[model samples]
Target: MAVTRWIAVAASVLSLGTLFVAPPDAPMKKTDAFLDAETTGVLGIEATECFDDPAYSRMANDRVVIYRPCEESADNQAFGFVYAPDGAFDRPAVAALGWDRCGAAFGKLWRGGSAEGLDFYPVLPTAETWADGDRALMCVVYRPGGKLPGSVLPLAN
Candidate 1:
Protein backbone atom coordinates (compact mmCIF):
# COMPACT_ATOMS: atom_id res chain seq x y z
CA MET A 1 0.00 0.00 0.00
CA ALA A 2 3.02 2.35 0.04
CA VAL A 3 3.81 4.75 -2.84
CA THR A 4 6.68 2.70 -4.25
CA ARG A 5 4.77 -0.56 -3.90
CA TRP A 6 1.80 0.97 -5.74
CA ILE A 7 4.02 2.27 -8.51
CA ALA A 8 5.70 -1.10 -8.95
CA VAL A 9 2.37 -2.88 -9.03
CA ALA A 10 1.03 -0.47 -11.63
CA ALA A 11 4.14 -0.89 -13.77
CA SER A 12 3.90 -4.66 -13.52
CA VAL A 13 0.28 -4.59 -14.53
CA LEU A 14 1.03 -2.39 -17.51
CA SER A 15 3.85 -4.61 -18.64
CA LEU A 16 1.74 -7.75 -18.38
CA GLY A 17 -1.21 -6.05 -19.99
CA THR A 18 0.77 -5.07 -23.04
CA LEU A 19 2.85 -8.21 -23.24
CA PHE A 20 0.39 -10.86 -22.18
CA VAL A 21 -3.11 -9.53 -22.74
CA ALA A 22 -4.09 -9.40 -26.39
CA PRO A 23 -7.08 -9.89 -28.67
CA PRO A 24 -8.49 -13.35 -29.02
CA ASP A 25 -6.82 -15.40 -31.71
CA ALA A 26 -9.26 -15.58 -34.58
CA PRO A 27 -9.07 -16.07 -38.34
CA MET A 28 -8.93 -12.74 -40.16
CA LYS A 29 -9.00 -11.32 -43.71
CA LYS A 30 -8.16 -7.97 -45.21
CA THR A 31 -9.72 -5.68 -47.84
CA ASP A 32 -7.88 -2.72 -49.25
CA ALA A 33 -10.27 0.21 -49.36
CA PHE A 34 -8.51 1.76 -52.32
CA LEU A 35 -8.05 -1.40 -54.37
CA ASP A 36 -10.66 -3.86 -53.14
CA ALA A 37 -13.30 -1.66 -51.64
CA GLU A 38 -16.02 -3.29 -53.67
CA THR A 39 -15.66 -6.64 -51.98
CA THR A 40 -14.95 -5.03 -48.60
CA GLY A 41 -17.97 -2.74 -48.55
CA VAL A 42 -20.05 -4.73 -46.13
CA LEU A 43 -23.57 -3.36 -45.88
CA GLY A 44 -25.23 -6.22 -43.97
CA ILE A 45 -24.51 -9.41 -42.04
CA GLU A 46 -26.32 -12.70 -41.49
CA ALA A 47 -25.71 -15.11 -38.59
CA THR A 48 -24.82 -18.68 -39.38
CA GLU A 49 -23.29 -21.48 -37.30
CA CYS A 50 -20.55 -21.03 -34.68
CA PHE A 51 -18.04 -23.77 -34.85
CA ASP A 52 -14.33 -24.43 -34.92
CA ASP A 53 -12.29 -25.05 -38.02
CA PRO A 54 -13.61 -27.94 -40.15
CA ALA A 55 -16.78 -28.04 -37.97
CA TYR A 56 -19.64 -25.88 -36.71
CA SER A 57 -22.18 -25.62 -33.89
CA ARG A 58 -25.71 -24.38 -34.29
CA MET A 59 -26.23 -21.27 -32.16
CA ALA A 60 -29.59 -20.37 -33.63
CA ASN A 61 -31.28 -20.25 -30.23
CA ASP A 62 -28.79 -17.88 -28.70
CA ARG A 63 -29.92 -14.50 -29.89
CA VAL A 64 -27.82 -12.56 -27.38
CA VAL A 65 -24.58 -13.86 -28.90
CA ILE A 66 -25.09 -14.89 -32.47
CA TYR A 67 -22.49 -15.54 -35.15
CA ARG A 68 -23.18 -13.14 -37.95
CA PRO A 69 -21.66 -13.76 -41.35
CA CYS A 70 -20.43 -10.46 -42.71
CA GLU A 71 -22.57 -9.77 -45.82
CA GLU A 72 -20.74 -7.36 -48.06
CA SER A 73 -21.62 -5.85 -51.43
CA ALA A 74 -20.09 -3.07 -53.40
CA ASP A 75 -20.54 -1.22 -56.67
CA ASN A 76 -20.54 -3.42 -59.79
CA GLN A 77 -22.31 -6.24 -57.95
CA ALA A 78 -19.44 -7.35 -55.79
CA PHE A 79 -20.27 -9.65 -52.86
CA GLY A 80 -18.32 -10.85 -49.83
CA PHE A 81 -18.78 -12.05 -46.24
CA VAL A 82 -17.18 -11.54 -42.80
CA TYR A 83 -17.96 -13.37 -39.57
CA ALA A 84 -19.19 -11.58 -36.47
CA PRO A 85 -18.97 -13.00 -32.94
CA ASP A 86 -21.87 -10.94 -31.61
CA GLY A 87 -24.62 -9.03 -33.33
CA ALA A 88 -24.55 -7.41 -36.79
CA PHE A 89 -24.52 -3.80 -37.84
CA ASP A 90 -23.08 -1.33 -40.31
CA ARG A 91 -20.71 -0.17 -37.59
CA PRO A 92 -19.40 -3.72 -37.39
CA ALA A 93 -18.80 -3.56 -41.12
CA VAL A 94 -16.70 -0.49 -40.47
CA ALA A 95 -15.04 -2.29 -37.60
CA ALA A 96 -14.22 -5.22 -39.86
CA LEU A 97 -12.23 -2.95 -42.17
CA GLY A 98 -11.00 -0.64 -39.45
CA TRP A 99 -7.43 -0.40 -38.13
CA ASP A 100 -8.19 -2.02 -34.77
CA ARG A 101 -10.06 -5.14 -35.82
CA CYS A 102 -9.21 -7.56 -38.62
CA GLY A 103 -8.59 -4.72 -41.07
CA ALA A 104 -8.80 -7.30 -43.87
CA ALA A 105 -11.32 -8.72 -46.24
CA PHE A 106 -12.84 -12.02 -45.07
CA GLY A 107 -12.22 -15.20 -47.04
CA LYS A 108 -14.20 -18.44 -47.40
CA LEU A 109 -17.67 -17.46 -48.49
CA TRP A 110 -21.02 -19.23 -48.70
CA ARG A 111 -22.70 -18.62 -52.01
CA GLY A 112 -26.49 -19.04 -51.94
CA GLY A 113 -26.62 -22.52 -50.32
CA SER A 114 -23.13 -23.77 -50.74
CA ALA A 115 -21.07 -25.68 -48.18
CA GLU A 116 -17.81 -23.69 -48.28
CA GLY A 117 -17.05 -19.95 -47.97
CA LEU A 118 -13.99 -19.95 -50.16
CA ASP A 119 -15.81 -21.38 -53.12
CA PHE A 120 -16.65 -18.01 -54.63
CA TYR A 121 -14.43 -15.43 -56.28
CA PRO A 122 -14.65 -11.70 -56.78
CA VAL A 123 -17.70 -11.23 -59.01
CA LEU A 124 -16.30 -8.30 -60.92
CA PRO A 125 -12.59 -8.26 -60.34
CA THR A 126 -11.95 -6.31 -63.52
CA ALA A 127 -14.74 -3.80 -63.07
CA GLU A 128 -14.29 -0.21 -61.99
CA THR A 129 -16.63 0.83 -59.21
CA TRP A 130 -15.84 2.89 -56.15
CA ALA A 131 -18.84 1.95 -53.98
CA ASP A 132 -20.55 -1.42 -53.51
CA GLY A 133 -23.93 -3.00 -53.92
CA ASP A 134 -26.34 -4.53 -51.35
CA ARG A 135 -26.15 -8.27 -51.51
CA ALA A 136 -26.54 -11.10 -48.98
CA LEU A 137 -23.43 -13.25 -48.71
CA MET A 138 -21.50 -15.42 -46.26
CA CYS A 139 -17.76 -15.23 -45.66
CA VAL A 140 -15.46 -17.94 -44.54
CA VAL A 141 -14.66 -17.81 -40.83
CA TYR A 142 -11.08 -19.01 -40.85
CA ARG A 143 -9.79 -21.07 -37.99
CA PRO A 144 -8.04 -19.34 -35.13
CA GLY A 145 -4.27 -18.79 -35.58
CA GLY A 146 -4.49 -19.33 -39.33
CA LYS A 147 -2.88 -16.65 -41.44
CA LEU A 148 -4.69 -14.90 -44.26
CA PRO A 149 -4.43 -16.52 -47.64
CA GLY A 150 -2.71 -14.92 -50.61
CA SER A 151 -6.00 -14.08 -52.30
CA VAL A 152 -7.66 -12.31 -49.39
CA LEU A 153 -7.37 -8.52 -49.55
CA PRO A 154 -6.58 -6.11 -46.69
CA LEU A 155 -9.24 -3.76 -45.35
CA ALA A 156 -8.12 -0.13 -45.10
CA ASN A 157 -10.55 2.19 -43.36
Candidate 2:
Protein backbone atom coordinates (compact mmCIF):
# COMPACT_ATOMS: atom_id res chain seq x y z
CA MET A 1 0.00 0.00 0.00
CA ALA A 2 1.18 3.55 -0.65
CA VAL A 3 2.36 5.58 2.34
CA THR A 4 -0.05 8.42 1.77
CA ARG A 5 -2.87 5.93 2.03
CA TRP A 6 -1.63 4.84 5.43
CA ILE A 7 -1.46 8.46 6.57
CA ALA A 8 -5.01 8.91 5.46
CA VAL A 9 -5.98 5.90 7.51
CA ALA A 10 -4.16 7.25 10.52
CA ALA A 11 -5.91 10.57 10.23
CA SER A 12 -9.24 8.84 9.95
CA VAL A 13 -8.49 6.73 12.97
CA LEU A 14 -7.64 9.80 14.98
CA SER A 15 -10.97 11.44 14.20
CA LEU A 16 -12.97 8.29 14.85
CA GLY A 17 -11.71 7.56 18.31
CA THR A 18 -11.39 9.24 21.69
CA LEU A 19 -8.32 7.66 23.25
CA PHE A 20 -7.63 10.43 25.76
CA VAL A 21 -10.22 12.85 26.96
CA ALA A 22 -8.20 13.77 29.99
CA PRO A 23 -4.72 13.33 31.32
CA PRO A 24 -4.64 9.97 33.09
CA ASP A 25 -2.35 11.19 35.87
CA ALA A 26 -1.47 14.44 37.58
CA PRO A 27 -1.11 17.36 35.24
CA MET A 28 2.47 17.81 34.13
CA LYS A 29 4.21 20.83 32.65
CA LYS A 30 4.29 20.84 28.84
CA THR A 31 7.68 22.22 28.09
CA ASP A 32 9.86 21.55 25.02
CA ALA A 33 11.86 18.98 26.91
CA PHE A 34 8.66 17.57 28.32
CA LEU A 35 7.09 17.32 24.87
CA ASP A 36 10.16 15.49 23.59
CA ALA A 37 10.05 13.16 26.54
CA GLU A 38 6.37 12.53 25.96
CA THR A 39 6.97 11.88 22.28
CA THR A 40 9.75 9.46 23.13
CA GLY A 41 7.48 7.64 25.54
CA VAL A 42 4.64 7.45 23.01
CA LEU A 43 6.93 6.06 20.32
CA GLY A 44 8.38 3.63 22.82
CA ILE A 45 11.95 4.69 22.15
CA GLU A 46 14.90 5.86 24.19
CA ALA A 47 15.53 8.99 22.11
CA THR A 48 14.39 10.89 18.99
CA GLU A 49 15.52 13.54 16.52
CA CYS A 50 13.35 16.66 16.35
CA PHE A 51 13.37 20.07 14.71
CA ASP A 52 11.21 23.14 14.23
CA ASP A 53 9.20 23.85 11.10
CA PRO A 54 7.70 27.16 10.01
CA ALA A 55 4.57 25.27 9.21
CA TYR A 56 4.13 24.65 12.91
CA SER A 57 5.94 27.73 14.13
CA ARG A 58 2.89 29.55 15.32
CA MET A 59 2.34 30.06 19.04
CA ALA A 60 4.29 27.58 21.16
CA ASN A 61 3.82 24.67 18.77
CA ASP A 62 6.45 22.04 18.01
CA ARG A 63 7.04 19.03 15.77
CA VAL A 64 8.99 15.86 16.46
CA VAL A 65 10.25 13.02 14.27
CA ILE A 66 11.09 9.49 15.40
CA TYR A 67 14.02 7.70 13.84
CA ARG A 68 15.40 4.40 15.06
CA PRO A 69 18.11 2.18 13.58
CA CYS A 70 15.43 -0.24 12.44
CA GLU A 71 13.93 -3.50 13.65
CA GLU A 72 12.17 -6.24 11.76
CA SER A 73 9.26 -6.12 14.14
CA ALA A 74 8.78 -2.35 13.78
CA ASP A 75 9.56 0.16 11.10
CA ASN A 76 10.31 3.36 13.06
CA GLN A 77 10.14 6.51 10.94
CA ALA A 78 7.22 8.65 12.09
CA PHE A 79 6.45 12.18 13.25
CA GLY A 80 4.04 13.94 15.60
CA PHE A 81 3.39 17.47 16.86
CA VAL A 82 1.80 19.71 19.46
CA TYR A 83 0.35 22.93 18.08
CA ALA A 84 -1.33 26.24 18.97
CA PRO A 85 -1.18 28.61 21.87
CA ASP A 86 -4.09 28.69 24.21
CA GLY A 87 -5.08 28.40 27.83
CA ALA A 88 -7.21 25.74 29.54
CA PHE A 89 -5.50 22.55 28.48
CA ASP A 90 -7.11 20.80 31.40
CA ARG A 91 -10.62 21.28 30.05
CA PRO A 92 -12.09 18.37 28.11
CA ALA A 93 -13.47 20.68 25.45
CA VAL A 94 -10.08 22.27 25.01
CA ALA A 95 -8.51 18.88 24.56
CA ALA A 96 -11.15 17.97 21.98
CA LEU A 97 -10.32 21.12 20.03
CA GLY A 98 -6.67 20.18 20.08
CA TRP A 99 -7.50 16.75 18.71
CA ASP A 100 -9.50 18.33 15.95
CA ARG A 101 -6.65 20.63 15.03
CA CYS A 102 -4.22 17.74 14.94
CA GLY A 103 -6.57 15.77 12.72
CA ALA A 104 -6.89 18.71 10.38
CA ALA A 105 -3.15 18.98 10.03
CA PHE A 106 -2.87 15.29 9.17
CA GLY A 107 -5.75 15.58 6.73
CA LYS A 108 -3.78 18.16 4.79
CA LEU A 109 -0.76 15.86 4.69
CA TRP A 110 -2.92 12.99 3.45
CA ARG A 111 -4.48 15.13 0.72
CA GLY A 112 -1.03 16.16 -0.48
CA GLY A 113 -0.26 12.46 -1.00
CA SER A 114 3.13 12.51 0.68
CA ALA A 115 2.74 10.26 3.71
CA GLU A 116 2.47 6.56 4.43
CA GLY A 117 1.93 3.76 6.93
CA LEU A 118 1.22 5.93 9.96
CA ASP A 119 -0.83 5.92 13.14
CA PHE A 120 -1.53 8.95 15.32
CA TYR A 121 -3.04 10.19 18.57
CA PRO A 122 -3.42 13.51 20.33
CA VAL A 123 -2.05 14.68 23.70
CA LEU A 124 -3.76 17.32 25.75
CA PRO A 125 -1.96 19.89 27.85
CA THR A 126 -2.66 19.73 31.55
CA ALA A 127 -3.47 22.51 33.97
CA GLU A 128 0.10 22.56 35.13
CA THR A 129 1.30 23.11 31.59
CA TRP A 130 -1.32 25.77 31.09
CA ALA A 131 -0.33 27.50 34.27
CA ASP A 132 3.24 27.34 33.07
CA GLY A 133 2.23 29.06 29.78
CA ASP A 134 2.03 26.01 27.52
CA ARG A 135 -0.81 26.05 25.00
CA ALA A 136 0.00 23.27 22.59
CA LEU A 137 -2.32 20.55 21.37
CA MET A 138 -0.10 17.59 20.55
CA CYS A 139 -0.36 14.70 18.09
CA VAL A 140 2.06 11.77 18.11
CA VAL A 141 2.48 9.55 15.04
CA TYR A 142 4.02 6.14 14.36
CA ARG A 143 3.95 3.19 12.00
CA PRO A 144 2.37 0.03 13.30
CA GLY A 145 4.73 -2.46 11.62
CA GLY A 146 6.78 -0.47 9.13
CA LYS A 147 9.36 2.31 9.15
CA LEU A 148 9.33 5.46 7.07
CA PRO A 149 12.23 6.00 4.67
CA GLY A 150 12.66 9.71 5.45
CA SER A 151 11.29 12.90 6.96
CA VAL A 152 7.62 13.85 6.65
CA LEU A 153 8.26 17.54 5.84
CA PRO A 154 8.67 17.09 2.09
CA LEU A 155 5.51 15.06 2.10
CA ALA A 156 3.72 17.85 3.91
CA ASN A 157 4.53 20.21 1.09
Candidate 3:
Protein backbone atom coordinates (compact mmCIF):
# COMPACT_ATOMS: atom_id res chain seq x y z
CA MET A 1 0.00 0.00 0.00
CA ALA A 2 1.02 3.56 -0.51
CA VAL A 3 2.61 5.04 2.60
CA THR A 4 -0.18 7.56 3.02
CA ARG A 5 -2.92 5.01 2.54
CA TRP A 6 -1.30 2.56 4.91
CA ILE A 7 -1.04 5.27 7.51
CA ALA A 8 -4.74 6.05 7.19
CA VAL A 9 -5.74 2.44 7.66
CA ALA A 10 -3.42 2.00 10.62
CA ALA A 11 -4.75 5.11 12.31
CA SER A 12 -8.35 4.00 11.85
CA VAL A 13 -7.64 0.55 13.21
CA LEU A 14 -5.80 1.91 16.19
CA SER A 15 -8.43 4.48 17.02
CA LEU A 16 -11.22 1.93 17.08
CA GLY A 17 -12.92 2.18 20.48
CA THR A 18 -9.84 3.57 22.10
CA LEU A 19 -9.45 6.74 24.12
CA PHE A 20 -6.21 8.29 25.45
CA VAL A 21 -7.44 10.39 28.29
CA ALA A 22 -4.72 11.51 30.64
CA PRO A 23 -4.47 9.46 33.79
CA PRO A 24 -5.81 10.97 36.99
CA ASP A 25 -3.34 12.94 39.12
CA ALA A 26 -3.28 10.32 41.88
CA PRO A 27 -1.97 7.65 39.54
CA MET A 28 0.46 9.69 37.52
CA LYS A 29 4.11 8.95 38.13
CA LYS A 30 6.85 11.50 38.70
CA THR A 31 9.71 11.47 36.21
CA ASP A 32 13.02 13.10 35.28
CA ALA A 33 14.92 13.06 31.96
CA PHE A 34 11.75 13.14 29.93
CA LEU A 35 13.81 13.38 26.73
CA ASP A 36 16.74 11.09 26.06
CA ALA A 37 20.14 12.14 24.75
CA GLU A 38 19.13 11.52 21.17
CA THR A 39 16.03 13.63 21.58
CA THR A 40 17.39 16.33 23.82
CA GLY A 41 19.89 19.14 23.00
CA VAL A 42 18.33 19.40 19.60
CA LEU A 43 15.30 20.90 17.91
CA GLY A 44 13.46 19.94 14.71
CA ILE A 45 15.67 16.92 14.17
CA GLU A 46 13.95 14.06 12.33
CA ALA A 47 13.81 10.54 13.62
CA THR A 48 16.72 8.64 12.18
CA GLU A 49 14.76 5.49 12.98
CA CYS A 50 11.62 4.25 14.70
CA PHE A 51 10.80 3.25 18.30
CA ASP A 52 8.08 1.44 20.20
CA ASP A 53 6.83 1.29 23.79
CA PRO A 54 9.69 -0.98 24.82
CA ALA A 55 12.14 1.66 23.70
CA TYR A 56 10.53 3.96 26.19
CA SER A 57 11.54 1.64 29.05
CA ARG A 58 13.70 4.30 30.65
CA MET A 59 10.70 6.31 31.85
CA ALA A 60 7.49 4.95 33.37
CA ASN A 61 5.25 7.82 32.46
CA ASP A 62 3.72 7.57 29.00
CA ARG A 63 3.97 11.34 28.86
CA VAL A 64 7.75 11.15 29.12
CA VAL A 65 9.37 10.36 25.78
CA ILE A 66 12.82 8.83 25.41
CA TYR A 67 14.54 8.16 22.14
CA ARG A 68 15.87 4.70 21.27
CA PRO A 69 17.82 3.87 18.13
CA CYS A 70 15.70 2.42 15.38
CA GLU A 71 18.03 -0.55 15.14
CA GLU A 72 17.16 -1.28 18.75
CA SER A 73 13.53 -1.84 17.80
CA ALA A 74 11.03 0.51 19.39
CA ASP A 75 7.49 1.82 18.86
CA ASN A 76 7.56 5.57 18.49
CA GLN A 77 9.89 8.14 16.94
CA ALA A 78 10.77 11.55 18.26
CA PHE A 79 9.94 14.08 15.61
CA GLY A 80 10.80 17.19 17.60
CA PHE A 81 10.37 19.14 20.82
CA VAL A 82 7.83 21.77 21.90
CA TYR A 83 8.28 23.93 24.94
CA ALA A 84 5.17 23.95 27.10
CA PRO A 85 3.64 27.34 27.67
CA ASP A 86 4.19 28.72 31.13
CA GLY A 87 1.25 27.77 33.38
CA ALA A 88 0.03 25.34 35.98
CA PHE A 89 0.59 21.70 35.19
CA ASP A 90 -2.99 20.95 34.30
CA ARG A 91 -2.85 17.81 32.18
CA PRO A 92 -5.57 18.63 29.69
CA ALA A 93 -4.47 22.21 29.26
CA VAL A 94 -0.82 21.32 28.81
CA ALA A 95 -1.74 18.59 26.37
CA ALA A 96 -3.77 21.02 24.32
CA LEU A 97 -0.85 23.40 24.18
CA GLY A 98 1.54 20.63 23.28
CA TRP A 99 -0.69 19.36 20.52
CA ASP A 100 -1.08 22.79 19.03
CA ARG A 101 2.67 23.29 18.98
CA CYS A 102 3.24 19.84 17.57
CA GLY A 103 0.66 20.38 14.88
CA ALA A 104 2.44 23.47 13.69
CA ALA A 105 5.77 21.72 13.76
CA PHE A 106 4.39 18.76 11.86
CA GLY A 107 2.95 20.99 9.22
CA LYS A 108 6.27 22.73 8.78
CA LEU A 109 7.99 19.37 8.47
CA TRP A 110 5.44 17.36 6.52
CA ARG A 111 4.12 20.09 4.24
CA GLY A 112 0.51 18.96 4.32
CA GLY A 113 1.07 15.31 3.71
CA SER A 114 -1.73 12.94 4.65
CA ALA A 115 -1.72 12.39 8.40
CA GLU A 116 -3.77 9.22 8.18
CA GLY A 117 -1.69 6.26 9.30
CA LEU A 118 0.53 8.55 11.31
CA ASP A 119 -0.18 9.35 14.94
CA PHE A 120 1.30 12.46 16.43
CA TYR A 121 1.13 13.03 20.17
CA PRO A 122 2.84 14.91 22.95
CA VAL A 123 4.89 13.68 25.88
CA LEU A 124 4.02 16.17 28.56
CA PRO A 125 5.32 17.03 31.99
CA THR A 126 3.82 15.74 35.21
CA ALA A 127 2.84 18.14 37.96
CA GLU A 128 5.92 17.32 39.95
CA THR A 129 8.22 17.96 37.04
CA TRP A 130 6.31 21.07 36.18
CA ALA A 131 6.87 22.37 39.66
CA ASP A 132 10.51 21.41 39.27
CA GLY A 133 10.52 23.59 36.12
CA ASP A 134 10.33 20.99 33.37
CA ARG A 135 8.74 22.63 30.38
CA ALA A 136 10.08 20.80 27.35
CA LEU A 137 7.40 18.69 25.69
CA MET A 138 8.47 15.98 23.28
CA CYS A 139 6.45 15.63 20.11
CA VAL A 140 6.47 12.17 18.56
CA VAL A 141 4.99 10.33 15.60
CA TYR A 142 4.33 6.63 15.22
CA ARG A 143 2.26 3.93 13.67
CA PRO A 144 -0.11 2.59 16.29
CA GLY A 145 -0.35 -0.88 14.80
CA GLY A 146 3.31 -1.79 14.21
CA LYS A 147 6.87 -0.69 13.46
CA LEU A 148 8.00 1.74 10.82
CA PRO A 149 11.04 0.52 8.91
CA GLY A 150 12.62 3.95 8.59
CA SER A 151 12.39 7.59 9.51
CA VAL A 152 9.03 9.14 8.63
CA LEU A 153 10.64 12.52 8.20
CA PRO A 154 10.31 14.30 4.93
CA LEU A 155 13.42 14.11 2.79
CA ALA A 156 15.55 17.17 3.10
CA ASN A 157 16.39 19.26 0.07
Candidate 4:
Protein backbone atom coordinates (compact mmCIF):
# COMPACT_ATOMS: atom_id res chain seq x y z
CA MET A 1 0.00 0.00 0.00
CA ALA A 2 2.90 2.40 0.73
CA VAL A 3 4.30 1.86 -2.78
CA THR A 4 0.93 2.62 -4.34
CA ARG A 5 0.67 5.90 -2.41
CA TRP A 6 4.12 7.01 -3.59
CA ILE A 7 3.23 6.34 -7.21
CA ALA A 8 0.06 8.38 -6.85
CA VAL A 9 2.03 11.24 -5.27
CA ALA A 10 4.59 11.20 -8.09
CA ALA A 11 1.94 11.41 -10.76
CA SER A 12 0.30 14.41 -9.07
CA VAL A 13 3.57 16.36 -9.04
CA LEU A 14 4.21 15.72 -12.72
CA SER A 15 0.74 16.82 -13.70
CA LEU A 16 1.06 20.02 -11.73
CA GLY A 17 4.28 20.98 -13.49
CA THR A 18 2.54 21.13 -16.86
CA LEU A 19 0.64 24.23 -15.79
CA PHE A 20 3.78 26.35 -16.15
CA VAL A 21 4.38 25.41 -19.76
CA ALA A 22 4.31 28.08 -22.47
CA PRO A 23 1.03 28.61 -24.29
CA PRO A 24 0.61 27.38 -27.86
CA ASP A 25 0.49 30.93 -29.27
CA ALA A 26 1.87 34.03 -27.66
CA PRO A 27 3.46 37.35 -28.67
CA MET A 28 7.10 38.03 -27.88
CA LYS A 29 8.51 41.39 -26.90
CA LYS A 30 12.11 42.64 -26.63
CA THR A 31 13.79 45.83 -25.47
CA ASP A 32 16.98 47.53 -26.65
CA ALA A 33 18.68 50.94 -26.90
CA PHE A 34 17.63 53.40 -29.61
CA LEU A 35 18.21 56.99 -30.65
CA ASP A 36 16.50 59.77 -28.72
CA ALA A 37 13.83 61.75 -30.58
CA GLU A 38 15.30 65.22 -30.14
CA THR A 39 18.60 64.71 -31.90
CA THR A 40 17.39 62.34 -34.61
CA GLY A 41 14.45 64.64 -35.43
CA VAL A 42 16.44 67.85 -35.37
CA LEU A 43 19.18 66.58 -37.62
CA GLY A 44 16.57 65.66 -40.20
CA ILE A 45 16.26 69.24 -41.38
CA GLU A 46 19.18 70.99 -39.65
CA ALA A 47 21.94 68.78 -40.90
CA THR A 48 20.67 67.37 -44.20
CA GLU A 49 19.03 70.44 -45.68
CA CYS A 50 20.32 72.32 -48.72
CA PHE A 51 23.74 73.92 -48.27
CA ASP A 52 22.17 77.36 -48.27
CA ASP A 53 20.43 76.67 -44.97
CA PRO A 54 22.23 77.67 -41.75
CA ALA A 55 21.36 74.32 -40.14
CA TYR A 56 23.62 72.53 -42.60
CA SER A 57 26.84 74.31 -41.71
CA ARG A 58 27.08 73.14 -38.12
CA MET A 59 29.00 70.55 -36.14
CA ALA A 60 29.06 66.84 -37.04
CA ASN A 61 29.65 65.55 -33.54
CA ASP A 62 26.09 64.91 -32.41
CA ARG A 63 25.42 61.38 -31.09
CA VAL A 64 22.61 59.68 -33.03
CA VAL A 65 21.54 56.08 -32.47
CA ILE A 66 18.44 55.33 -34.54
CA TYR A 67 17.65 51.63 -34.33
CA ARG A 68 15.56 50.16 -37.13
CA PRO A 69 12.70 48.81 -35.01
CA CYS A 70 12.13 45.82 -37.29
CA GLU A 71 15.66 44.52 -37.66
CA GLU A 72 16.61 41.14 -36.19
CA SER A 73 20.11 42.32 -35.46
CA ALA A 74 20.54 45.80 -33.92
CA ASP A 75 24.33 45.74 -33.83
CA ASN A 76 24.95 48.28 -36.57
CA GLN A 77 26.47 51.65 -35.74
CA ALA A 78 28.19 52.07 -39.07
CA PHE A 79 24.80 52.19 -40.73
CA GLY A 80 23.97 54.94 -38.17
CA PHE A 81 21.65 57.83 -39.10
CA VAL A 82 21.78 58.91 -42.73
CA TYR A 83 19.74 62.08 -43.22
CA ALA A 84 17.28 62.85 -46.05
CA PRO A 85 14.22 64.97 -46.85
CA ASP A 86 10.91 63.60 -45.60
CA GLY A 87 9.05 64.37 -48.84
CA ALA A 88 8.12 62.22 -51.83
CA PHE A 89 11.73 62.35 -52.94
CA ASP A 90 12.97 60.89 -49.65
CA ARG A 91 10.34 58.17 -49.55
CA PRO A 92 12.30 56.00 -51.93
CA ALA A 93 15.50 57.22 -50.35
CA VAL A 94 14.39 56.14 -46.92
CA ALA A 95 13.21 52.85 -48.38
CA ALA A 96 16.66 52.49 -49.91
CA LEU A 97 17.98 52.30 -46.38
CA GLY A 98 15.96 49.07 -46.41
CA TRP A 99 12.81 48.14 -44.55
CA ASP A 100 15.00 47.21 -41.61
CA ARG A 101 16.77 50.53 -41.35
CA CYS A 102 16.54 52.09 -37.86
CA GLY A 103 15.48 55.55 -39.03
CA ALA A 104 12.29 54.17 -40.51
CA ALA A 105 10.33 56.42 -38.11
CA PHE A 106 7.05 54.92 -36.96
CA GLY A 107 7.38 51.77 -39.05
CA LYS A 108 6.54 48.58 -37.19
CA LEU A 109 7.36 44.94 -37.74
CA TRP A 110 4.79 42.87 -39.55
CA ARG A 111 3.09 39.92 -37.91
CA GLY A 112 3.21 37.90 -41.07
CA GLY A 113 6.71 36.91 -42.13
CA SER A 114 5.96 37.70 -45.78
CA ALA A 115 4.61 41.26 -45.45
CA GLU A 116 6.18 44.68 -44.78
CA GLY A 117 5.04 46.88 -41.88
CA LEU A 118 3.51 50.32 -42.48
CA ASP A 119 5.88 53.30 -42.58
CA PHE A 120 4.37 56.17 -40.53
CA TYR A 121 7.40 58.39 -40.25
CA PRO A 122 6.79 62.05 -41.13
CA VAL A 123 9.26 64.14 -43.07
CA LEU A 124 10.28 67.74 -42.35
CA PRO A 125 12.89 67.34 -44.99
CA THR A 126 14.03 70.14 -47.24
CA ALA A 127 17.59 68.90 -47.24
CA GLU A 128 19.75 66.58 -49.32
CA THR A 129 22.74 65.60 -47.18
CA TRP A 130 21.77 64.24 -43.79
CA ALA A 131 24.02 63.43 -40.89
CA ASP A 132 24.37 59.77 -40.04
CA GLY A 133 21.22 58.20 -38.54
CA ASP A 134 19.18 61.37 -38.98
CA ARG A 135 15.79 61.25 -40.71
CA ALA A 136 12.44 63.06 -40.53
CA LEU A 137 10.16 62.45 -37.58
CA MET A 138 7.40 59.89 -37.75
CA CYS A 139 4.14 60.37 -35.88
CA VAL A 140 2.78 56.93 -35.07
CA VAL A 141 3.09 53.22 -35.88
CA TYR A 142 0.08 51.00 -36.19
CA ARG A 143 -0.24 47.38 -37.25
CA PRO A 144 -2.80 46.24 -39.79
CA GLY A 145 -6.12 45.51 -38.10
CA GLY A 146 -4.40 46.57 -34.88
CA LYS A 147 -2.71 43.20 -34.56
CA LEU A 148 1.13 43.12 -34.89
CA PRO A 149 4.47 44.53 -33.84
CA GLY A 150 7.04 46.64 -35.69
CA SER A 151 8.68 43.48 -36.93
CA VAL A 152 6.93 40.20 -36.76
CA LEU A 153 8.95 37.73 -34.81
CA PRO A 154 10.57 35.40 -37.33
CA LEU A 155 8.61 32.16 -37.70
CA ALA A 156 11.73 29.97 -37.62
CA ASN A 157 11.13 29.09 -34.00
TM-score to native of every candidate shown = 0.22, 0.43, 0.57, 0.27
- Those runs of model 3 whose alpha carbons end farther than 4 Å from true positions after fitting are 1-50, 54-67, 71-73, 112-116
Superior by lDDT: candidate 1 or candidate 4: 4
Q: Give the per-residue lDDT digits (tens) of candidate 4, residues 1-157.
A: 9999999999999999899887664322211112224434334422212111012223545544333334332221121243444444453455444334443422233343443533222322333433443454322232323333333333335
Best by lDDT: 3
**Better candidate by lDDT, 2 or 4:** 2
Between prediction 3 and prediction 4, which has the larger lDDT? Answer: 3
Can you tell me which runs of candidate 4 are displaced by over 4 Å?
22-25, 28-113, 116-135, 138-157
How much lDDT does candidate 4 score? 0.36
User: Tens-digit lDDT track for model 2 on 1-157?
Assistant: 6899999999989976766566455422221223432332333432223222112323435444333443322333233555555544446676566557766766765554444556444555556656767565555444444333444433322
**Per-residue lDDT tens digits of candidate 3, residues 1-157?**
6999999999987897367755444322212233432333233334453554432234453333334576665566777777777776787777788779887987777665555566666667767778888787777776655655566777678
Give the residue spans of candidate 1 off by over 4 A: 23-27, 30-55, 59-157
| lDDT, model 3, position 92 | 75
After best superposition, candidate 2 residue 22: deviation in angstroms? Answer: 32
Clash pairs, model 3 backbone: 7-116, 7-117, 8-117, 51-74, 51-75, 51-76, 52-74, 52-75, 52-76
- Whole-structure CA lDDT of model 1: 0.32
Note the Cα lDDT for every prediction shown. Answer: 0.32, 0.47, 0.62, 0.36
